[model samples]
Target chain A: MGLLSKKDAKLITDPLADNNPVTIQVLGICSALAITAELEASIVMAIAVLFVLALGNVVISLMRNIIPSKIRIIVQLIVVATLVIIVDLVLKAFAYELSKTLSVFVGLIITNCIIMGRFEAFALANTPGKAFLDGIGNAAGYGLILVIVGFFRELLGSGTLLGMQVLGDPIEKTGVYAFGYENNGFMLLAPMALITLGIIIWVQRSRNEALIEDH
Target chain B: MEKRTDKNSYTIIFATVMVIIVGSMLAFLATYLKPQIDENKRLEKQQNILYALGINDNDEKSVVFISTKDVAEKFDKYIVKQIIIQGDKVTEDDNAYLLDLKKEHAQAKDKGHQRRLPLFIGEKDGEKFYIIPMLGKGLWDAVWGYVALDKNLVVEGIFFDHKGETPGLGANINQRFFMDDFKGEHILDGTTFKGITVAKGNADPKNERKEDFKVDAIAGATITGDGLTAMIKKDLRMYMPYLQTLNK
Candidate 1:
């Protein structure tokens, strides 16, 4: 806490609540829908996004002064791609087992709207340190929603959490299955992810009325 | 006055410079890491092959391969022979396992190029496992696996993996539940090599009826299941002529 002043600290804290990337800005919904079918996937995606977003923001911020505005978007895209590939290559070399898990997310990370969103919105105008914090905050906030959705989806859909049969084996008809509680096949689908995300947005807006717009 | 960065020539130069820097950096890193990455992949291939032979460190629920540090020794101990069948010119090759299937597939497509098929024959407790490697297309990207069979052509064990299948859905192909179900399933329907099918709604969730040549498909993974099914059929059928000799 002492390492950051209040202004810099807000760069980290604000996105977790007020400027929440997924819920408020509604960015990165693609990945939130795609990977949140399981808690493990959501967690993996969260970590992947966090790593990319933070490092990418710092890189973009450092280059902001010299970057030509005409092709800034392309530059951002290239940067993201380079960073993701470099990380993947390093992981494959040093941590072979972990690389297998992370490699699957490489394409997902490079294409994430959140990384681009943060680069254009915050990094282009901010210092490297502030952009890094903002990246961490936004990614965390996004991950928080993904984890929530993933929890409900995996719990209800598969009757499991992180592949653990917490509700007992569905096939064996033990534990919760004994209570005649059936798993909802719909929860595993993308529509359910959208609906779950909508519910979170609704709840978040209710908690903070400022998040809602009078249309 | 236009800023230095805002000029047309500046934008082009910036683009060119960025590309060169990023490109060289990436190319250099890839080159530097090639050895280690290739080593990891080699180790992984051994682990996957051994896994299909049922020589692993798996538990009640997980698909844990033998540790990398000890895998080379264990692979040598279990796998008695490595054979390559190139259009009936079958021969023993210690390094046959290293043959890149992707390259072989590409070459085989060329005129007069016979696909070199690598097979590992593993021996444990006086039992033999004829392990075959396969590659197929999943919904998102390439899906591949290794399947081991006994003399009767019944699947002994299997290991499935993918490049970019959907997590928790299609990617569950590598999970224990899906891979374990293939065990004891026959690849042949009475002298005819009929590869096993991942049938959905076949009323066989338990996979007890191995003779039916069907395994219950993973829920929400229709494409990956089909890919695995096709991979087994396509790749295994190629080796039938050579495999059929085992029974004789």
Candidate 2:
């Protein structure tokens, strides 16, 4: 898990590509859709989720034996939420404007299936270090899809990336580029996130024909 | 053999400890940051009001010139009075301009206690501006906005936002064309009360005397448009008697 061994390296790096969460496992798609409208906001949200999910997994794994079997889920939830409150407070302190922009998406990270999925699937049985790496890799997988979706959505939706003007205005305003800077503003909306994510799934599956052909 | 604790004892201890730790931590955090959060919300409200008034305070250099105190003073001096009306009676709330509606909503239900409505009156140059709060139903939830008027009671500007409305359609109230269409439309004429109307196409081309204040509903968002129209008409109609005081 420290990158000292082959099996540990495989567990850590594989989720980045072949065993990707969004592309392969298809976990955590809800936040991926809700926050991927802006590249800046999506990146911020991704980092926050990565921190919470990984830390929650590590802490829960560390406490695995001591936690009563009957109330394990509740314990995990409490730890995750405490971490979330800290993150929420930090954001309100340092990034008040962005915090407002992100709204409830930050708090919703607790409900994100990726964190709980890892708690149930990886954290309970796995070593603390391995559980942490697994959490990081899975979070990276979620972040990858979000960044891709956000890249396209922000570019097309606003004719800008990270709020900077990339595509020039239509000829009427004296700039170039024919795709038109006018907001197909719908792309900025949440439904567009679903459509783009669906497309990503389609393309990924088509390339890996064995997934479809296996049945 | 290790002494095994009773299951009931562990359960009670765990719940109690977790509750105390989590609850105290939250209490501590809230106590520390509540003031900063309150200040941010206050500044944000001031900015919203400034935007509605069409005051350009964007330049970084101007940030030094425009502080919350400046905005508050300007708002206080020019936006002179706040009136609360229920049925035919009108009473004044001195701090109505500063009153937070989010706080106002939490008061004990007084079926008999009157709802204190705040009207912001700001003057620029010599013209009086009436800033009225507009609230109504949107497609999915409650929509609220501010409609500002000049001394003549013609529309000045509007700033609308909603809880959950379709982004491209109903949410277009945030756009200028919709809000600007409200500018220059008079809500009253002397003693006769002519409530503002929201029309389709173009409002039956106004006369020279009444050229500026006309609102046309956004074409496709008929339900939202109708709702907004009804909202403005209803809220302004309530403030009609209070507004008549400005003419004197």
Candidate 3:
């Protein structure tokens, strides 16, 4: 009952909606722009970040009591970096092609502000159980936005999802559709990712008045 | 207990222990995963080589696509000879497969140094082709490729890859449209080596000399294109002695 308590449930579900990390907190926007051009890369990035965030939160929370306040940031960084390196190594071993496609972004997860932000803002003050839930909640929030943006970007820019042809490629197959749908090349660029985020933010804020900032 | 936890000495001790643990974990993971990583790299290299030799079947009607399982067998079937050439001398070294072209090129650039260049000789449908591996610096990072030339020194096929390049601009070097343009371009001009030029959208098809040596560069990726051209010329020049001997 303690594990499934209403408060514990709120800690997990809050970030997925009203307290969304990307839309509300506006954390981890850099990776969202860089890797969302393709759905597969975006998904991999999300999973990598999720793994780092969850483990980092748990590790930090477990050590929060003994950690000297003066060196807390350094401790958090070490944990996050170690987790990132482990994720990078696992990806290289199990999913080499995707790992290559990800390249430095997986390594760059150490620099992602969301992981550090959680350690400082939540994990440091919370119990390990609550911190773990918060970590997962924030990661899901970030991952949801990434997958949504990636879905649109891949669908429009490449006429594919996860490299599978969803729409008939006009360049490859002519007369497959009544009206040829040329891929929107602009959608592949970084600017489109920003636009996609803006749209998500807009829809999210409209749906939940709580997300709007008070003037 | 509270006083002990806040002390500088305590922090140092905790930090030291944490670092040791983290360091060993990373070292262990890297060592354990090295084999799989190396295998993936080997298979990827084989696939790239087979692709450059134009043996990688993409036709859906035939076999759908060349899977990872098929790359090793296909590579062995097509690549009949592995020759190492160093300044007019050819050595039959199966270790050519293991040669790091980038490292060899760097050593060659040093004073009073000789580099052994690996050349893969492939036979497809009774016609033989020479495959030369190339390495170069792109705008951001390393760019590498394989060039396969027919007996006449005309480009048969090419496969380009990059470590880190601007996507949609420089990274398009790997695309079929860019590699396809190299086909039929002559790598030699009347016994003199004239490496393929990646012209900046100004390649003149009407001019016989330009047509023979030049291919259209990727628009908006001039640096990568230039790097590719320079890489092709520099690497191919090293193997010119072998090529010339074959001509004789």
DockQ per candidate, 2 decimals: 0.79, 0.26, 0.32
DockQ of 1: 0.79
What tier of docking accuracy does candidate 1 attain? medium
lDDT tens digits by residue: candidate 1, A92-136: 999888888877788988888989999999999999988999999
DockQ of 3: 0.32
* lDDT (Cα, tens digit) per residue for candidate 3, span A189-210: 8889999999999998888787
Which window of ten consecutive residues has the lowest lDDT sum in model 3 chain B? B57-66
TM-score of chain A of 1: 0.96
Off by over 4 Å in 1: A1-3
TM-score of chain B of 1: 0.96
Best by lDDT: 1
For candidate 1 chain B, the 10 contiguous residues with the lowest summed lDDT are B202-211
What C-alpha lDDT, on a 0 to 100 scale, does residue A119 get in candidate 3? 98
Worst 10 residues of 2 chain B by lDDT: B56-65
The parts of candidate 3 lying over 4 Å away from their true place are A1-3, A91-98, A164-167, A172-182, B1-4, B57-74, B165-230
lDDT of 3 by residue, B1-248 (tens): 55667888988999899889989999999999999989988888888888888877655422122578988888889999999887667798865877997788679779987788899999999999999999999988999999998888888988898987764457668876677778778888888999998887464433245335888776557899999999999888887778777867
Candidate 1 lDDT, tens digit per residue, B1-248?
88999999999999998889989999999999999999999999999999998989999999899999999999999999999999879999999889989999899889998889999999988988899999999999999999998878888899999999998799899999989999999878789988999999998777889899899998788988888889989999999999998788
TM match of model 3 to true structure: 0.83
